[model samples]
Target: MKAEFVCTDCRKQFIAEGIKNEYTDPVYGPCVIYTAECPLCGGEGREYSPNQGGDDHEHGMGPSCPSGGCCPGCGGM
Candidate 1:
C-alpha cells in the first residue's frame, strides 16, 4: 500500500510505499507494523492522511494545527 505524509518540521509533503504488517488478536493485541523515511527532510512525525494511518488533512497556512502550531499555508510559505 501507498500513503502520503506531511512533515510538520520542514513542511515537506511526500509519499511512502512499503509492506504493511497488521497484528490483531483477541487476547493479544492490534498492533500495526510499518516503517517509512521522509523523502524530503528525512524527518519523522510526518502526519499521514486520515484515511491511511495519520491525522486529518489541514489545508492552507491560514489555519494552524488543532493544538495551535506552525501553519504551512497553501504553498504560501
Candidate 2:
C-alpha cells in the first residue's frame, strides 16, 4: 500500500510506507495519525491522498518507507 506524502521542507510529493497510528487524543478522543519520512531530505511527511487529501500532483521515486513497510495507495485508505 503505497501512499503519497508531502515533505514539510521541500513540499515534494512522494510515495512511502504509512504508519497507521491509532490512539486517544484526549481532547479529540480517538484519532488516526499517518506518518512517513521523506527519502530525499529525511524530513517528516504528512500523509496525502489523491481523492481526499488534495488534487493530483507529481510523484517522486523511492522505497515506500525507511522501515520498509508497505503503504496504502491513492483513492484508498
Which candidate comes out best when scored by TM-score? 2
The parts of candidate 1 lying over 4 Å away from their true place are: 19-28, 45-47, 50-77
TM-score for each candidate, following the candidate numbering: 0.37, 0.53
Clashing pairs for predicted structure model 2, backbone only: 1-71, 1-72, 2-71, 2-72, 17-64
Candidate 2, which segments miss by more than 4 Å at Cα? 49-77
Model 2 Cα lDDT, one tens digit per residue, 1-77 = 46888887777789999888789988999999787889989888888744443422212222332233234443221
Error of 2 at 35 (Å): 1.1
lDDT of 2 at 28: 93
Instruction: Using lDDT, give the best candidate's number.
Output: 2
Task: Note the Cα lDDT for every prediction shown.
Answer: 0.55, 0.66
Error of 2 at 57 (Å): 18
- The Cα error of candidate 2 at residue 62, in Å, is 32
Which pairs, if any, clash in model 1?
61-73
